[model samples]
Target: MMKVLLTGGAGYIGSHVAVSLAAAGHDIVCFDNLSNSRAAVIEHVEAITGQPVPLVVGDIRDRDAVRGAITDHGANAVIHFAGLKAVGESVADPMKYYDNNVRGTLSLIEAMVDCDVRTLVFSSSATVYGEPQYLPLDEAHPTAVTNPYGRTKLMIEEMLSDIAAADPAWRIAVLRYFNPVGAHDSGLIGEDPNGVPNNLMPFISRVAAGRLPELAVFGDDYATPDGTGVRDYIHVDDLAEGHVAALDRIRAQDDALSVWNLGTGQGYSVLDMISAFERINNVRVPHRVGPRRPGDVASCYASPDRARDELGWEAKRDLDAMCASTWRFERTAAMRNA
Candidate 1:
């Protein structure tokens, strides 16, 4: 079994990927600071995978600790996912985002180089293709990040590409993910945001649980079928599988750098998602109209052709599955707190 080091394996997407990688027979060591995640995530991952996910509680910025973790775990590859992701917070504190996201990645890459772990699968975002000029954005779309979060992702993509160019031995896979929602099927693990969530599904779940007052529907005046911002909301499980597929592709290649869009090749507006969640969860999500935030796009979806052809990965879960799994997670979270 190949050893893999997951930078943020305790977080939402990272835990799911850790489970997936373990199921595929890979030894994983998660390196995280626990700044945005819970320590109980290890139990959830073990319960799901039926194996312990070795923990290395440390920050990616700690070059010595990161290098030691790689050596101790005997990691042959690194999946970098440790980064601050709140868009609003990034705007409010761009330097914090830059230091944590950009500098963290650079430090991780440097540690990987020191540890001789050249294989890497970076967690990128579709926000790099800001304000889509086209309907279905391909990998060729222009990257114009309007937010600090998006800028961090775009800048890292450039850094990875340049690194690969300099070193021929590095086999890198940059997976530009779409809006990843939902949770694992078992409901043992899912997103556990520290405070009020900034994402759409989490907000909706909170509203259903009475934790939040109401869902603030941001701008129904956008030019779309339902007059709401449309986005490619891929299931978190599918997104996790995409990471596995990317690793598989990276292992097969002798010396090559690859990038693919991880998405379902479909678009759903804010209203569409709310309706789908309501139908699946059987709960009324109270919401109110709100002003449109700046840098908000009308619509953005992935083509997924590159991922299909390159990595042989396709998002299998539908909207219903996404909603059901997410609700299951919410139920579990409520029970745990109780």
Candidate 2:
């Protein structure tokens, strides 16, 4: 029965993790700036959990606001997810990523320290591994980030490590995620990005829903079987549960800092994902193959063995489940908006 504060609780992954945490009998407070998300997400989460979650409309870069949220709710732990995401955006404006992802994390931790809430589960990305040196990237893989987005994540990881080393009282778990797709089974809450989505799954969903014209298959000439970039697309629900699992482990153990990769340990090319979505949902997704984007990798997946062994968590949903749920949510959202 931990009282947790989710920094970006109204966002896609944060909302799902909020539901998961509530189901696990934990109280949660969502602190978000609503920059890339909507306030209606808090209502949607309430609908899913049948429990009220406090929404604090604030930025993580504001230490006073963060501290107030933690102190006001008496939160015992923090799941830091308030940060800008999107590789192209990060590259176009590297300063924004540094200010939000890196500086925002520093501010959040400072607030946590002030509030004496040391347990944290950070949302990191596998992009830190960069262009994979080996297949099934493990935690020990050398981090040579290729883009500003990846650099921000790696910088935060290093910062957290240094912090935990300086103060053993701080318990932190960094989960490096692969691609997270799909939606909740209820179809009530899913990835609803503003404007053009930067990720593959949401972009595909929009294209299938007729909101977008076609999906751009970036880098079809990559050195893969299908000549497209391959990624490990874990279901969003599974990723949410992984956060809960990491939270549980950090709370139970005295380990100052722990890092785990949250992924399916399997690779799916861009074509493979498109084909799966079409086959599973019986829908056509119009797509066009364009030249490879800069800083794109040929293949990237995860080992996921550390999370399995340490946290006893593994992605359970299959590719079909991911596609079906995503399509279901897309249709449901379209109808509701109409």
Candidate 3:
């Protein structure tokens, strides 16, 4: 098993990936700043895996701390998930996004080079695709990000490409995730975004749990089948498994930079998702039609062919499972918080 250092490992996707890696018998060191996540998540991860994951509390931008964590843990690989992710927030403060996302990645890469650990699995987003030039976005789709959040992902992808080109020893996997939803089946941890959530599934969860009054169905006039925006929402566990698959593939390769989309290749409209949540959970989600936010797309999903054919991985969970798991987590988290 590989010794992997997970940056932002206490966060939603990071924590799930940590659990997956630990379950697969990998030694995991969780490094996080705790800026947007809680330290208690590490406890949940340990509880789920029945294995203690060492926590290194530090910022990714701190080169010394990053290097120390890598060297101290004897980490053979790094999974980068530390960054600002909100598109609206990124637009409001572009500098913050660039500094944390771009500069932070630079620091981590420098530390990796210093420690001679080259294998990397980067947490990228479909936002890098920007306004989808076509449906079922493939890795070959031209990248033209709309917001600063997306721009940072695109910039990091480019940076990794350049680094790989310069040094043949670097092995990188840029997993462009479409729309990651759901939580672990244990319902021990899930998406716990600070303040209001920017994504759809969490918002629906909150509304269903009565933490929020209602959901906002943005842009009902879009040209989708239901006139609402559509997205490919994959289960977080499935996405985490994709990371494990990526780590295995990258470890086997000598020198390669691979890009794959982790998604279901199926699009579900906003109303469709809400209906699924309500039907599955037997809860009413009061929602109203709202104006389309800036930089919002009508429909966005993934091709998922390359990841399937190459990495021997495909999303196995369906939409109903995603909704039910998220609602379960939301209720569990709410009770714990209470």
Candidate 4:
């Protein structure tokens, strides 16, 4: 069994990936700073996975700490999910974005090199595609990041490619994820964004939970069926599974440093998502149409053919499942807060 080091393993996606990797029988060692996550998540992850989360509570910027985790755990690979993520927040604090996202990644790579652990699975984003040139964005689409957060993602993708080129010993999986919603089926461990959530699903959840006043339907004048932006929403479980599939590929020596999009290849408009959330929770969400936010695109979804063909991964959960799982998590968030 391989001992895998997962950076940001305490966050939403990393926690899910930790459980997924553990379920696949790989020993997990998580390295995290807990900036946007809670220590309690580790307990809940243990509850869901039926195993303890062996974690190294530290920042990715700390090279010595990263090297220690790699050497101490003998990690065969690292699935990196640690970084600043909010688009608006990134725009406001580009220096923090560069420091943590870009510089921190460089430090991690340095530590990995020193520790002789070359395998990596990076958490890229659809934001790299920026304004979609066309519907169902494929891997070949033109790349442009509209926000600083997206720039960090794009920069890392390029950096990984360069590092792999310099030394083929680096086995990397760059998974450009689409809209990730929903929670684990257990309803115990889920996304708990501290303050205001920048993404769609959590905002909806907060509104449904009565924590927020109303949902701001950004850009209701977009050229879509419902006059709203469209995105390909993928289940967190499927994305987690995709990471496992990527690890399998990396371990099996089939392909290294390959990139794939993790999505369902199905586009859902904002109104469609709201309707589905309402149907699943049996609650009417109060919302108002607002002007298009800066850097907001008209449509952006994924073409999942590459992930299906290459990694043998496909998003199996539908919109209903995504909404249902999110509502379940939302219902318990109050208890978690207290």
Best by TM-score: 2
Model 1: number of backbone collisions: 0
Candidate 4 per-residue C-alpha lDDT over 1-338 given as tens digits, one digit per residue, 9 for 90 to 100: 67889899889999998888889998898889998988888888898888877878999899999999999888878999999998778888899999999999999999999988888999999999998888789999999989899999999999999999889888899999998999999887677787888889989888988889999988888888889989899999999999999988877774558888999999998889999999988987889998887767888899999989988889898899999998888877677667
Residue pairs clashing in model 2 are none
For all candidates in order, the CA lDDT equals 0.90, 0.93, 0.94, 0.89
- Residue 77 miss distance in model 3 (angstroms): 0.4
What is the per-residue lDDT of model 2 for residues 1-338, given as tens digits with 9 covering 90 to 100? 99999999999999999999999999999999998888898898999999999999999999999999999899999998888888888888999999999999999999999988899999999999998889989999999999999999999999999999999998899999999999999888999988899999989889988889999988777789989999999999999999999999988888899999999999999999999999998889999999877667899999999999999999999999999999999998888888
Candidate 1 residue-wise lDDT at 210 = 86
List, residue by residue over 141-182, the lDDT tens digit for candidate 3: 999999899999999999999999999899999999989999
lDDT of each residue in 38-127, candidate 1, tens digit only: 879888898888887889999988899999999987999999899998877888889998999999999999999888789999999998
Q: Residue 156 in model 2: shift from native, Å?
A: 0.3
Q: How far is candidate 4 from the true structure (C-alpha RMSD, Å)?
A: 1.2
Can you rank all candidates by lDDT, best first? 3, 2, 1, 4
CA deviation > 4 Å runs, candidate 1: none
Candidate 4 stretches with Cα past 4 Å from truth are none
The clash count for each model shown is 0, 0, 0, 0
Which whole-number lDDT from 0 to 100 does residue 145 have in model 4? 89
Question: Which number leads on lDDT?
Answer: 3
